[model samples]
Target: MGILTSPIPIQAIKTLCTNCGVRDLCLSIGLSNEDVERLASIVTQRVKIRKGAPLYHAGEPLRSLYAIRYGFFKTTITSEDGREQITGFQMAGEILGIDAISENRHACNALALEDSEVCPIHFPQLERLSHELPSLQSNFNKLLSREIVRDHEMLLLMGNLNADERFAAFLLNLSHRMLSRGYSPHAFVLRMSREDIGSYLGLRLETICRAIARLREMNIVRISGRAVEILNLDALRGLVAGCNRHRQS
Candidate 1:
């Protein structure tokens, strides 16, 4: 277990959605200025989580849904035998703790991969606000739908793809997401370690290392420790497609 720290108090400060950098990608999207102000009211506190510390633990009662203001996080679940399975990696502008909506307790643990800050939205207040704000309700529904689609995609990725293909898909997926967040798609740093990535992808650490070497040999990517630069974006995408390219128009 990582060392836990108390959340820094910020009663004097408030981060409003109108001034937030990631508002376009977050809940403020498609919302009126008034709606955003209403949201800002409920999001009264911002909590900073230290690296390696959990934002929330599994089976803990869900009090708030977190909007990641900065940094990276990984969600995982532990089995009865104490085997931990990485469920997903989340980044800035993404929401966490949605999995607890049905059970009222977190099904997985959320931990910061680096020093992070999150705006905690109290669940009950959000529910009442959503009732009055149709746009908020619609956006919340979309968030839920997106989670379901992501899960289905992961199932397909693990079930149908070979190791190499899975590795390619993972890189391409990361690239796309980074691009969406206004980061360079061709080059980026990996926040999670290779072992953490393996856990998420259901591959061995050695297998991940080999995949990196194989990509380098093919002149498709350049990897130096945690930094990765895709040398041939099209070639990398083709790797993910594999034989399926022949079937597509």
Candidate 2:
């Protein structure tokens, strides 16, 4: 577990969404100035979690949905045999705990991959406010729909794509998401471990290593430990598309 770093003061954390450059990609999008101001009232003071700390555990009662102010997280589920499966990785500006909205309890554990800060939006208050604000309600619906689409895409990747193609699609998806958050599309650190990534991609760690090595050999990406620099995004996309064509055939 990584040590917790110094966190911003509560007062400073309160302005997170309002001052966030990526607010356009978050739930705050399409909100009026007044509504954005109102939003600040419902959000709890930013809470910091150390790497390896569970932000919320499976079966915990859902109190609020969390918005990542900064850093990264991995959500996982443990099976009856005690095997853990990585469900997803979340980055800054993304929402967590949406799955709990359906059953009123968290379905999986959300763990911090690095020192992180999150804004907890009181779910009941958010629901009440959304009733009066049609735009807010619409945005909330969109968020849920987006999650469904993402899940469907993941299923497609896992079921249809070969190992190399699965790895390529994974990198491309991460690049797109990071680019949307104003990060460089061609380079970034992989916050989660190779084992966690393997779990998420439904591959063994050895297979992941082989795929990465192959990509590097092809000069499609330059990887040093966890740092990745995509050298040929077009070639990577072609690999993904080619896999889809093979699947269709």
Candidate 3:
């Protein structure tokens, strides 16, 4: 099959327009439109990240916060046993490395699951800017809070839900999120492989495959390689109704 290309048309970028898309997450969140443009001028051009490429790695100095413009990202943390525990996925318009604001090194490995583009907001420059600009501080603070909420949710999901339940809920969550972003809600590409998804959901690779097959058999999902079509969200969410029980063993 031919590669899928981005649909956005090429145009000359003025500072204002480039910051508009990621204002709430990467640039100035609550700043007036004019302030965002002032900040945008300092940012680098959009950088393409190929599939399986590392955007940043664990223990690397947190030189910048990356704002994903398109495609998917998976981050992981390696433990003492050398096992990588999947952290979370970063979608387009989301900020990466926000959690490392206080830390000098990145805590997780960030990898592109598909071809992607990210705009790097250099940390040293941003930190200085933040100290000088009230808008930058407010925006970064808001981003920090958002990251905390997301991480808290991930911790809760991992600590409480079983593999199958977590997988189902994750699919529902992804579908809903993409839909909210005006992307295809039912049909979309899976940027990550089954192994990556399984790791994130705390399931065996084979179990992930089996779960997808089960969803297909139940007419809830149609899966083809990395392409998935959610046939039924209501039924999928039903699989883990009120599954808030944390791991006790």
Residue 185 of model 1: what lDDT?
98
Per-residue lDDT of candidate 1, residues 1-249 (tens digit): 453334433333233567787887787788887788787778867788889999999999999999988889999999999999999999989999999999999999999999898888889999999999999999999989999999999999899777777888888988998998899999999999999989998999998888888889889899999999999999988878774332111
Q: lDDT for model 2, on a 0 to 1 scale?
A: 0.86
lDDT, candidate 2, 38-139, per-residue tens? 776787476788888988989999899988888899999999999999999999888999989989999999999998878888899999989988988888
Task: Kindly list the per-residue Cα lDDT of model 3 for residues 1-249, writing each as its tens digit.
Answer: 112323232232335344455445456656666666556655656567878888888888887887777778899999999998888898887888865666888888888888887767778888888888887788777778877888787787779776666777888878877886677888988877889888888888888877777778778788898888888877777775753322311
RMSD in Å for all candidates? 3.6, 3.2, 5.1
- TM-score for every candidate vs. truth? 0.92, 0.92, 0.82
lDDT of each: 0.86, 0.86, 0.74
Q: Alpha-carbon error at 167 in model 1, in Å?
A: 1.3
